[model samples]
Target chain A: MSKNLHTSAPDTDTAIDRNVPEFPVAQDSDEQNYFKTNQPPSYLDQLHKSTKEFIQFHKDQGKGRKVVLVTSGGTTVPLENNTVRFIDNFSAGTRGATSAEYFLENGYAVIFLHREFSLLPYSRHYSHTTNCFLDYMTEINGELRIDPKYSETMHKVYKKYNDARDQNLLLLLPFTTVNQYLFSLREISKLLNLVGGRALFYLAAAVSDFFLPHSKLPEHKIQAQDHNGGKLVVNLDPVPKFLRRLVDSWAPGSLITSFKLETDKSILIKKSNQALDRYNHQLVIGNLLQTRKKEVVFVTKDPKIEPEWFRLSDEEVEKGVDIESLIIPAVIKVHEDWIKNHE
Target chain B: MSKNLHTSAPDTDTAIDRNVPEFPVAQDSDEQNYFKTNQPPSYLDQLHKSTKEFIQFHKDQGKGRKVVLVTSGGTTVPLENNTVRFIDNFSAGTRGATSAEYFLENGYAVIFLHREFSLLPYSRHYSHTTNCFLDYMTEINGELRIDPKYSETMHKVYKKYNDARDQNLLLLLPFTTVNQYLFSLREISKLLNLVGGRALFYLAAAVSDFFLPHSKLPEHKIQAQDHNGGKLVVNLDPVPKFLRRLVDSWAPGSLITSFKLETDKSILIKKSNQALDRYNHQLVIGNLLQTRKKEVVFVTKDPKIEPEWFRLSDEEVEKGVDIESLIIPAVIKVHEDWIKNHE
Candidate 1:
């Protein structure tokens, strides 16, 4: 349990733990109740048909290459049915968007399930930064052209984005609420299973841990004065552990990689290890909130194997090297190994 | 009190109500205590310096032209000091940003106090729409240029945005939490007082009605199982009514227009009139949640005067006529009349 990064394990030859912990039977009914009680996303029919087409197109285009389902952004938990207010997680989805680009570059088709208005794979390169989108444009002689300072980078990003669209390597789906996110995830997991173990699930979205059934919420906006002494109180139930169902029943024999984000760095690796043990997943990428943009530690199943840290050098960071460029490659390596082992 | 739009009243000659309701002295100490307890934003010094400079620059640029402080987007109620989760209002800043542009077009310098990363006045013409920002760009012979389909509109937007920046007619200041927004509003209201009766306050931001003092929230993320029956319960106090303070002392004699949004249409006009009566502000722009983008009602003092509706016809909407185009001009007319009457 050495917490130091890049430490070599003395017992590298220790066999990996193959035991699957018994599924949390107590929560299975709770999860089932969640799905039975909640309504599905509005555009689910279209999402399903389009996703099938995307997977089939790539399958016909190439036989043995991998496919990744990348979930990004933060899902909302609405406080009321009419939804004047909601609890939201603060995430810009930089990790998921950047990782999708790397996955596409690595020749894997990507299904990007993201929060509706959060960042996207290529468009994120321009918008939502310090400069406004209009800053890139200029009117010269009645023609609208990008400023010279940005044209080169814009061209490269646009070229890759265009390729992804034209070659059928990417599919974009948007979800707003945690309810929609969970339901879509369950359905998409079944669709991704068509590819067998060759599929990789990159669960990066900041899914809420707490939620309320639709019946529990007020029919209209909460009145501030009607509550206790002009105060508001919210009672929320825990969203069932859907990851267990995701790993156990929905996408059987698939490679699932989840992210563990912690504010305290002291317990980051330990919790990541626990997640792997509990869910029996392939990998857990552990990151601290403070240094997540620059570094991450990979936590695998074997207790004897010291967790490997991936980091961007200060020089590389200054040069604008994205850490996702490294994490994606590491993930693909294990994913490919899993595919080969399953075969 | 007919709810129908554009209904005219026979009592047109009735004198506008000059009676000011006695101020709620009870909440004055409550507001002061709240301000004393909450921390100001991190960038207070920079924001203060820039805002002062912006007001002075606009003053020297013109003698009698009115200046507007436009607050846009929605504020957050952070659940924790570190802020992993929070309550958020669902606002895209469409109403605020769109109105700011019209304000500028009417020859007024605008200080846009907005939520960080929300839509902006000129840049909003292209970004945050259904299409991605990259969709507007085309790679032509290794040059990044505007796509032909969007060039005309892009050029128009770029020209206006460029003009605003070059003339110092727009100053952008950003805030995230309700704490920062309230603090900034109080500070900016003081500075705006320098312009005397010429300053107009357009309070359009969807500030949170409920908030919690930092001392009340847990220091870390709320763990699910640690709570009763795996549920989370949050208690939040109502944000103090700052509009009363804004009218009586902060910017005395200024023309203040505040927006009142309601989901229940039956109560919309009644609440708007009550707000005007309670705050003694010049105008209350009342809007329904469903039809706000297309229509609004102007609620002034003298309940005898019927509310006047501003709307966009179907043909006008089809031709892309922004409702703000109509609303802003009407607002300007009332503002101008208010200035003349005060003189």
Candidate 2:
């Protein structure tokens, strides 16, 4: 029924489907073996305890507010167990953090699982930039206060932060390594399943598709002296397609939305549609790495539906309007429809 | 006449000198060639302007206040030009930033060249932690204020921040990739050299020892699909030892101190002494990754002098006394003697 698997593209490189496994082609069962082989992260017990508490607290409130679990930033794949060096994906967590604020604004409690020290929803206004935290404050009359130039924005961010905390709408969990990310993702998805249709998964994290399994990594730092004539060879196993399991088993009732980031202009829509078909997820938000902040395309699975584009106007960009504000409302509408139709 | 090269250690593995070139050995001149092969970073012009301005500003002040250029945090080595993935060294920039604060406290105008988003001197009180920045703040009667529990320490950090900025004692220059770091380091070193013996270099940044040359890297993201049966081979040239150049040519009169981090306890001293001999720099601060904050060894080249240990006592550790407080005073004493001997 899917017609565009290898449709003619505007570019010659369309023949290479980079995401699909071809060499020693991996099957779905390999993903199960991956979890069986690798040890679960040490933080799993702590995360489970926190997740259970968060879910129960929301249930006790009985506000019937939707819960969105937003994953942000990039997961690192360590080259060694002692981890002197590791490969990191390039992401600042701006999309995820900004979207979290919008989600919180529109009656959703957020579970923000992000890379440590990347960015937080309300704190995104000041933290994780080149600007020193002290730059935001001024000494006025022998007392420290927010600088007058930034007082207006600072006040807005501060109040929202307090409100979110007081209302118990924001819960933060952090992850660093790829192994920790996978373990936490599975645990969190299952935990959120307790809410059934009310749970939404926004998978914005740039996870590494390939990683050296913990078993293969050296116990100490990798020595540069051993490289064969300056050539360093690293073996990485494809991180199994956990998305299928995520849709089928874990959090099956939640509305799942994942992102597709591409550098090429020609294959963006085609690849996004392919992911939608493969995972059978509700939506794939497609973005280019360069223009991600200004524009994104919404690719849904229904054959008759055309892809939707949500873009920021130049004036909106000039006015400091986040594109996530527009994206979240559209996602909410889709979530509302999914809940109704599933019932 | 260095006597302690590979002094018998507690372990048999002590024979392996990890830093020694075993593969295709790279020479000192190859570093200069490597810089020419790679395109200079886009921000080079901007950084040069800032460095020039900062130096001129320091010169404009007649106090002849000793200037310290403290390099902090880890430098990343990108695997590709578009840079979807990079290998990162392990550092949170605590040592460099803490040392900078003590330097400023002891009357040195400081230039902080740090990894972007890593800790800053006075602002280290609040930023780059798992806790949200908002956690340190509270609102009462619609007025934003530092949380009362943290206000005492926050007040101290805040006042020092105001003092540093007001007196123009701090200049911050941030870098991300190794290429940018090398470029900036050279430029800043040269600029600091304009003041001759008055400058001090505290090199604490965890710089990468290996990197794929820019000419060898792919223009786009490195595709995982083409891995030879899950094995990814990456060829990395040894990062040229620029320390020798720094000691011999760039800022030769400055008192230079570098760091050596080792996981193996036995090799720590041997390696530290090797660096001091090879670079012929003034000092090498040796630390183990695990107990870096609690203790360090100060290695000097004077054959009669034994390696000095500056350690934190249990009581001092319990009291949250930073070992840098001790380390800085010792370094200052060394700096004072160096200045005196030169005069």
Fnat, 2 decimals, each candidate? 0.40, 0.37
Query: Measured against the native two-chain assembly using Cα atoms, what DockQ does each of the candidate structures obtain, in the order listed?
Result: 0.26, 0.34
Candidate 1 per-residue lDDT over residues A139-243, each given as its tens digit: 667677787788888889999999998888889999989999998998889998888898899999998877878777665554322112554556666777788
For candidate 1, report its TM-score. 0.91
lDDT of 1 by residue, B1-343 (tens): 2223223332212111111112222277888898899888888878888988988887777787688999999999988655678889878899999999999999999999999889999998777777878887776676777888888877888889989898889999999999999999998998888887789999999988778786676555432221125545566666878998899999997899999887778878877887787777889999877788899999999668799999999998899788899889999998898888887
Among residues 3 or more apart in sequence or in different chains, the pairs in candidate 1 whose N, CA or C atoms overlap within 3 Å are none
Error of 2 at B230 (Å): 3.2
lDDT for each residue of candidate 2 in B1-343, tens digit (9 for 90 to 100) = 2333323332213211233342233366677797789778788888889887877788778356788899999999887677777878888899999999999999988999999888889888788766778787777677777778877787789888889988988988888888888989988899888777788899999998777777677666544343234534444556778888888888898999998887878878877887887778999999988889999999999989999999999999999999999999998889888877776
Give the per-residue Cα lDDT of candidate 2 at B317. Answer: 95
The number of the candidate with the highest TM-score is: 2
- The models' CA-based lDDT, in order, is 0.81, 0.81
Expressed between 0 and 1, the share of native interface contacts present in candidate 2 is 0.37
Model 1 residue runs over 4 Å out of place are A1-26, A225-228, B1-26, B225-228
